[model samples]
Target chain A: MKLDSRKLKILQAIINDYIMTAEPVGSRTVAKKYNLGISSATVRNEMSDLEEMGFLEQPHTSAGRIPSDKAYRLYVDKLMQVRSLSEQEAEYIKDLYESKIMQLEQVILNTAKVLSEMTNYTSIALAPQLSMVTIKHIQLVPVDKSLALLVVVTSSGILKDTLIHIPEGIDSDYLYKVSNILNAKFRGKTFAQIDIRDLSDIRNELAENQKFFNSLVDVLTTSFREAENREIYLGGTTNIFNFPEYQDIIRARSFLNLMEEKDLLYNILVNSRNGGVKVSIGTENPYEELRGCSIVTATYSLGDRVLGTIGVIGPTRMEYSRAVSIMDHMGKALSRYLTKLYGEQP
Target chain B: MKLDSRKLKILQAIINDYIMTAEPVGSRTVAKKYNLGISSATVRNEMSDLEEMGFLEQPHTSAGRIPSDKAYRLYVDKLMQVRSLSEQEAEYIKDLYESKIMQLEQVILNTAKVLSEMTNYTSIALAPQLSMVTIKHIQLVPVDKSLALLVVVTSSGILKDTLIHIPEGIDSDYLYKVSNILNAKFRGKTFAQIDIRDLSDIRNELAENQKFFNSLVDVLTTSFREAENREIYLGGTTNIFNFPEYQDIIRARSFLNLMEEKDLLYNILVNSRNGGVKVSIGTENPYEELRGCSIVTATYSLGDRVLGTIGVIGPTRMEYSRAVSIMDHMGKALSRYLTKLYGEQP
Candidate 1:
């Protein structure tokens, strides 16, 4: 099983064909469709060799052979030529940035829409990971006797504001004083680098307002964790129907049910967080609902910080070359738009 | 054929059985099961009359009869006694609000989840209408040379903060001064009540910074319009697979596709906004994708201000009595939680 060049070519052709038609690729079909200067006999011999080497499988005893996930992983890593996006798709991405300055959420959402529309697969865009973003400002504004507002602005212009309890009553001057102290400690530091355990000295300084101080720390900690478990925006969820594998009620049900569970999707996207486009095929995905699927993801950043991931999900027979190319370009486009949006590198 | 008690009872029995079994009802089966004190012969004759009156139809002449959308509408309007939610369902809702204070978005999302889980049907919850909520506080915080944060707090504790352009160099004191004037005009007024058309006199004072003022007003107007077109949360989208009608690929595709469309769902929910529970059945729906579905909605409010609608959508053979009761209670529970979250009666 040395995987000679002729055998590799046959395996590649079978995978490319299966990705298109979702059917097993027979030697005759491949030989007739692709001019590889080989007869059906030679193609059939190579196909058998490829199957023996674990790159192909016969779904039925007498049917044509389909490429395995191992084959796709091979193609994605080496053999496949990543095609550039069509003019229309590039325009959609260009227009999203050009149409006007969009909020960060809208920019991520539009990226999901473009990816899904361009490659008829379920697309996901995770929000920027605020834990990785440096805190630029912190303010505590007194709202009323029982509630106060905690506003934290990040370096890339992302804001997190929540109504926190002020059970001890609001001392406007005191709250502003605490906010100033917090600003001094937290500015230019990522939440991941800052910890409650490291701030015992500051805690002792606010011993009289311990309850309010605890609430303040809780809000910041919660925001940091929430960013780690950020929102997953999905587009073309129903596009799962386009594949023959998901036409079955049982299969579609499992996939759609998986969509309802955010923790699982969060983990899936988070695991795909490499600096560049990464492809996870079939059993490579740990989630059972995705055992029959493949995922292609790329990290999209804000400013110089890698924010989160954006991906395309489809049946294991995915158009990996195109999906990777699109994701790579989309991730770059979003980074540029976000950096430009926040006044060019903040 | 003027409807009589016996005919109405038979039609009700048929629709009830169809809702549970998703099968057409036969007169013999109805008489045997319902024990309606009528013979099969009597029930059969009444069924014929009901079909003639357009309350029931047969897919094939040889098969049993099924209830029409008109029959379900009638049942929803006059015949069905809205049963109270089960003890378990009541506890689920009570626990949601009682557990902890939740953000408004989370409150709406959890409501949809509980509704869908209780009824085993796809559920929808529209976000609270900010246009109906009066403004409580407004602030403009200067971020940098080119950006400012616009923070608007609604009376109901909803916060909308967006980054707006500061085209002119930041004069921190001037922005604060202008903010005071804007607050004097906007406080205690709903976005719907406050319009750019009424603020021309104030525009004169801001004529020197016309571009900045225009950006400020544009942000407000967009926020107002966006609140009118707020997010619609969905739960149990795969619940469509539970119905036999959506088992077919074409039917399920259309239903799931409709799930992705927020504007159509927005219109559907908005049209369903009455003072109480409203049921739109089958052909009564305007959207073609929903022709075979029924939507039951109830208006949930914050204090006395009507916020938005929460709804359940399923095949036309909807469990009307249970869904109506659940929605009625769920809407009230949400209203109570929201009012309480905003510190009550504000």
Candidate 2:
């Protein structure tokens, strides 16, 4: 919907006031509080026009007006001013990025915690998927008489290990030899590109060591299948309770319950994956339980491939402009940090 | 407070009705629905006394009564009857336990999902801690020219991996030699029992190889430190919304927010570490934000050491007796699973 400058100002004032107080905004209240150089009657007339255009709503005949979904859309798209991060917030982000995290899980968790703490909203960050990156190296180590450890390291620096059972009497020297051969052949190849049909030929070429080669291929296939699974991280879910909008105990419980569903959350974040920042306002989310909340999400990437998304969730009347900016900046910082960690310097 | 048989029956009826309907129970309705052999007037008189004893509460003068915190306690301790799991539920749990999981994370996630689906309540399961378990074996494999991978397999069959950086030109043969020496020295000891003072002596023995030894120790420390961090899995969070009690969006969101707090959840689960089932009714939980809900928790163990907790969360009027029984059974099952995996099979 088109919004003229005067009407835009009125809508912005209503939204800003409503967000702060969580109370309806009357024409008189907006006119007096904002000093908009207009009388209450004129402001009321403008509000009526805004309502007709689906930008405002009134709860009852005597109540003041509030911003509608359309109004929030307009404000987010056109009128809302992106606020710069406070000095403390910028320092927090910088410190987080500078910290030496030992694993990708720690990095994702700390990022979510920092974002949620800064925004005073629930935050979610998904770890970079292993499938997007090629396997850099594979190592097999004999753990016991009958078991060997399969360690796989990806180009993105994620380390995954699994235990595979080898028949008794297999010497560590033979295991090492097989590991070397597999690493030489499979290094730098993505799991998707590995051909299962080639295993028989590879095993036949192992001379008298065909048994060990068959076991090695089986272990590698299992590891790749397991690696395709995704890991997700969430932080600061407790921040949701502090919002006035969730004062009711039942509503608070429902939202918390929804967060526990991994499948639902994975779908929510993955499906909303547009390249840049995307805001899903109240009722815009797919789940009915989240109809009263808004999600501000941004997809972060390592190079051109999207790694994962970072998002903040709050009441529908949330500070959309600030949330959008925070997510956008954090997304870029995370992307750059990930790229650096993966040795993709440009 | 002590309750006579009639009062006990009345309390049980009220709790059962409230759990099923999530609405206040009136004396007349109880008299009509239950074959208590009592008139509505008599039931009302008993309910009034129950309220005076803090076992029930009336929202208003003319409204029906709801179970109070005192009432839930009585029901949990004495009145409520524990029911056996339905055939479907038993089969579901069996199927879940029988499935071949890809990793420890999958096992925990699937366990949480099974509990939540069976109970129709939110479930949280914490991962077993690795530090308490002794290392079965350790293996080091060369990943690239500058990096190596360490795979540590615990006695309980859990696999943890860490990336170790090797100084520029270290060869695979040198790494293999170091791995053998380190394993001989540190294989059976838990990380907490490792002596740093003696580690320095070992480093001195390495001399020209000191850098690699130091790097290996760094990798080991990082692996154990990461494993010590609690991993929580949550399921059926959205089920909270389906309850009539959480019809108000505000209340649902507040409780949902509380569940999202990692520290809060850790504290809640760990504080009740009596190695048995624990029921914390309304206002009994340490956090005020969780005052309106009830948490039923039980700690699972590998032999004598408490590894983690598994619990269900619901409203104060929840089916306490059944929840406690389920938790108790699940705790034993998990402990047995761990014992079997660790070679302590019965």
Q: What is the interface RMSD of each candidate, in Å?
A: 1.8, 3.7
Q: What would the per-residue lDDT of candidate 2 be over residues A57-149, giving only the tens digit for each residue?
A: 898989998888777887898889898887887788889999876577778889998989889999987677667677787677776777777
Worst 10 residues of 1 chain B by lDDT: B337-346
Error of 1 at B74 (Å): 2.6
Least well predicted 10-residue stretch by lDDT in candidate 2 chain A: A337-346
Give the C-alpha lDDT of model 1: 0.83
- What does candidate 1's lDDT look like per residue over B135-172, in tens digits? 87777776667777888877778888888887756676
Candidate 2 residue-wise lDDT, B208-243, digit = tens:
876777886776666656666577778887777777
lDDT at residue B274 of model 1 (Cα atoms): 69
Model 2 clash number: 21
Per-prediction TM-score, chain B alone: 0.92, 0.92
Model 1 chain A scores worst on lDDT over the 10 consecutive residues at A337-346
Overall lDDT per candidate, in order of appearance:
0.83, 0.78
Off by over 4 Å in 2: A1-15, A18-24, A44-78, A198-200, A203-229, A238-275, A279-295, A303-305, A315-318, A344-346, B1-82, B209-229, B238-254, B271-295, B299-306, B342-346
